[model samples]
Target: MNHKPLRARRAPEVARAHILAAAETLLAQGGVDAVQMRAVARLAGITDAGVAHHFVDRHGLLTALIAYGGDKLRAMIDATVTDWLESEPDIGVLLAKLAGLYRQGYSGLAVALHAAGWRETGSPVLEKVVEALHAARFTSGVSAPDILHTRLVVAAFHHALATDPLFGTEFRRSAGISGSRDDGAALQLAWWISVTKRALGYDE
Candidate 1:
């Protein structure tokens, strides 16, 4: 089969995206250190210097990486919003969905980014996600209980996020699952399911 030659485009956005996408994958696999400039360039299919030319130094690149992660988290949350709107997910079901999301969505990255930069991207995205969900509870309000309505369910959720860290709590005791690498990702998915379901009143 004759393969068409790959066409190159010099669009700055495209190039920037290449770099960011490369950084994102690296962060997902091995956190920040995995996203060195040279590695990012190589992953982006560009010259090492090309990566530097795009961003002045590793700090700039790191900032971009953080930003990219935030963007990814926001998108993931948005997708979760759509999913929750699809069915009637109660608080428990919502917690399960959120737990699953933290396992896969950008929670780790978002947490890392928060450590680096206090400016909110995904949280606001999550809050907006929560806001949009208010219709589900028969009103558009995001309150503490409205989020879970019961601390027990929230306990199930935090267990998923913290991987059920030892806290001398009975829920923690019963909710224990042999911690897994994908635990956080799973929690994120479940969090979104809860957010949207609660917002739309499907949980009611």
Candidate 2:
């Protein structure tokens, strides 16, 4: 006797979420190139048609993926800010977390998306960081100039973190550090954290 296969029924939003999550896993494991529709569909336990139905095509999928990553990063920044406000203000921890996210293939995705004509009109993440740091500095009795400097410092740090995943090792090697070692990245992050702390008056 032949048995009919069971079909898994999920809401549209649920299916989309599953596909996006699978794509994210593939992206984290092998950059954007690995987030093919077939792979995502397989991982998502859905059909290729299903993935296409949601994202339309590869470009659409990638665009949505980038937006998804941005949302996650925003949430992380918000949580980090809340924690810093409620407890000890640790810029180093926040910097490290930002670096962690970028290193997880989101940096490459951002670069690819930008190269493909995706333009972000505003720097919401940077603005949030600046705002949080400004508040922290103001509460610590830091001078007006120092508090205002938070924007520049945060912007620089954000740029460095975003580019680090793509060029960090080669850049470090060019500066005479071993390319195979992560020591250079660690040292760079430490320096940024120190600079940020000094700028925000957290070093005192």
Q: Which parts of model 1 have CA positions greater than 4 angstroms off?
A: 1-7, 89-93, 121-123, 139-204
Residue lDDT tens for model 2, 1-204: 998998868898888788888987887667778889999999988889999999999889988887776666667767766766677666677777777767666677666655545555566656666777777666677666554577788878888878887899888888887845367778887887787787666764
Total backbone collisions for each predicted model: 36, 0
Q: Once superposed on the true structure, which residue ranges of model 2 sit more than 4 Å away at CA?
A: 28-33, 103-105, 121-123, 146-148, 201-204
For model 1, how does the per-residue alpha-carbon lDDT over 1-204 read when each residue is reduced to its tens digit? 999999776788888888888887777666667778888888888888888888878899988877777777667667766777677544455445554566463555555566667365435555544543444454434443455443333344444553322232334335663444345344545554565455344444
Each model's C-alpha lDDT? 0.60, 0.76
Q: For model 1, what is the alpha-carbon lDDT of residue 105?
A: 38
Instruction: Give me candidate 1's TM-score against the actual structure.
Output: 0.63
Clashing pairs in 2: none
